[model samples]
Target: MRLKRKVAMALTSVVAIGALSACGSTPSKTPAASGPKKLQIFSWWTGVASSKALNSLIGVFNKKYPGIKVINEAVAGGAGSNAKAVLASRMEANNPPGTFQVHAGGGTLLSWINAGYMAPLNSLYKQQGWYQDFPKSLLKMLTVKGNIYAVPVDMQRSNVLWYNPAIFKKYNLTPPTTFSQFFADAKVLKAHNITPLAVANHGNWETTLLYSDVLLGTLGPTQYENLLTGKAGTSWTSPGVVQATKTFLKMMQYANTDYSALHWQQADQMVAQGKAAMNVMGDWAQGYFTTALNLKPGTGFGWAATPGSQGTFAMVSDVFGLPAKLSNKTATKDFLKVLGSKAGQDTFNPLKGTFSPRLDANTSLYDAYSRSAMASFKKDQLVLVIGQGAANPGFTQAFENDMVTLLSSKNATAFTTAVESAAQSNPL
Candidate 1:
């Protein structure tokens, strides 16, 4: 369930600038020059692939700028909630790290921006010509009141279904294209004693995927946004939303008995090992595919969005927030330049199992799914996931909790009530 890495385990700490002088670890003479300083970067990158991605980017930075060293101070956490708490404590103490991971969305880094805890990147953005490279949808996420507060690293498609291709072929099943077709296929899978949905409910993010797919499939893109944005009331009891819940309940009924105890990797393994038929997860699950299971993306497994979705995609992005204290400073400016540089994005994203933030990234370096995601981004139909769409972490987790309770209990009325509660209590 834990996704972030232990910084102490993976990283060798560099002595802080002032600490070098305190310990007499610096060169002889005038009290240790703190010019073009080393950066202590904090992140929640735990997996081997994730660690490799961060270290690969650092390797690039090491070559390009010999003066600045990036000490990656990673922390093990649950989908970044633990990291966020630690980051807040540091900011409260007025001792923030040089950089930390944040999502590109209205509520993620914008609060820090508005509170003067994060730096604006207008100058760096313009200097690096990022305005032309980043997508408009991503730009909207990073911008707060017309000021850019974060740098987007990569994008992940939230509404993806990973299925065992061999199972599909043996069962003579084609990927479903509509909700009705999906349900029909589920029956076929169940008749053969196959678990249609391989889920890991104990991991909160895994459950959130179910809620997103249902909401998006039921409400479609436009109404889903309206509901999340508070433009419409929770009419969760509405035919569409309720029907979606029931539909999801049907899928859940076919789940393996140990779903509640499994982690994401275990569910992915179930499909990979042919113990299950399908999994609904974000695109990054492919990392567990190619690397851990030695499976190819399209050959060993396959990808498709939820049926009846009309090409609508759900997403959340990994973005970097610069501390407000460093915005106008020359040293921080130099670091941000490297961060948004072509080489920086190139080295970071492909290896990270996500699409580059810059629209101009060389797609040749990515695998099949990453390439498809980039192509999908160009179509401009991405809808922000519900958790990432909320204005606060409280709302995000509450929505996920309520949905989990609702589906786990198999009560449509209770689920609708929970949605109504989320709508009124959270207020977007």
Candidate 2:
């Protein structure tokens, strides 16, 4: 319904413009020459593999659009906090960049739209025919109030469990199926003086991942969606939710002693070095492991769907949101076209260890784990993870705070209460 309406509106505008262009009674005059424009893009990617991937895209973008100079404004801080803070402040000041990084969620972008800091790209979307290439479901994610606002670069599956094959073989353990088996394996690994779960709780995304696994794995799909959507009077106080939280905290006891300060990369190093048995993070970690640790799946390490979780894959795609009121410059349009093009996605997602957001891209470009993820995505429905994507950025922060406190204190009751308060205190 919405697509039809938008297409009709675009056609109407095109016809109207055509009528006006036909009425050329006056002599044509030479157009004024304009200088090249510079567009600054702000992002938080600082890791070796991530930065390399981004630079590769930037190099391609520069070649495709010669008149545009892109100045990278990358800030390093707690996960993505530093970059996010700067973007928020710049947007509020009406000094938004030409393009900025956005997560695959409704929370942060929705807030920006409400604040009048966002510009819809519906007309541009129609002109580029992105709707045909991007899947209907994936496109629906960036659509709000009947308008498209962003271009997704890739989709990250957050419920992946990575394990060291050498360690598993040494322990004579097979991949665990149910949650009971998972805990039992952890115990076995612990007795043998191996850190079973490699976790780095320093970032908000890490905390958010823990929340996602607990909610989706333990609370079940219906209840998880109900709680995230505020459709039911559900609270984290439920036995299922509490039990999940308790299990998460208990699992941390088997983690490395330096887990408190280690980053995800450091934790990944632990698994790569065979110092740890397992690590649960997004598939993007696979890129790092492959690049930095020289890992090969089914040999050095392996990937699996998180155990004890019976639900669809929960994902948040990384996208680029252009400023709404961009300068009517040729360079700007060139950049937008490149982003929406086929070559861009092909060049970006494979090295980043994520699949392209476009539904029509060649899945053959993906790695083994990515191929598995694509297979799951095709068969299993995808649910937008609320903590990462649907809820407001502030609400995400609140959840993160509660998680950090709960994990460090190891108090399930306090954690449940904190989550309840966060849910009740609407950040919208």
Task: Report the C-alpha displacement of residue 76, candidate 2, in angstroms.
Answer: 3.3
For model 2, name the residue pairs that clash: 105-389, 119-324
Q: TM-score of every model?
A: 0.87, 0.85
Evaluated with lDDT, which candidate comes out highest? 1
lDDT, candidate 1, at 55: 91
Candidate 1 residues lying further than 4 Å off, grouped into runs, are 1-36, 232-238, 326-328, 388-391
- Score candidate 2 by lDDT: 0.75
Candidate 2 lDDT tens digits, 326-377 = 5443555566677667788788777667787666778889777788887777
User: In candidate 1, residue 334 scores what lDDT?
Assistant: 63
- Cα lDDT, model 2, residue 389: 79
Best candidate per TM-score, number? 1
Model 2, runs deviating above 4 Å: 1-33, 325-333, 385-387
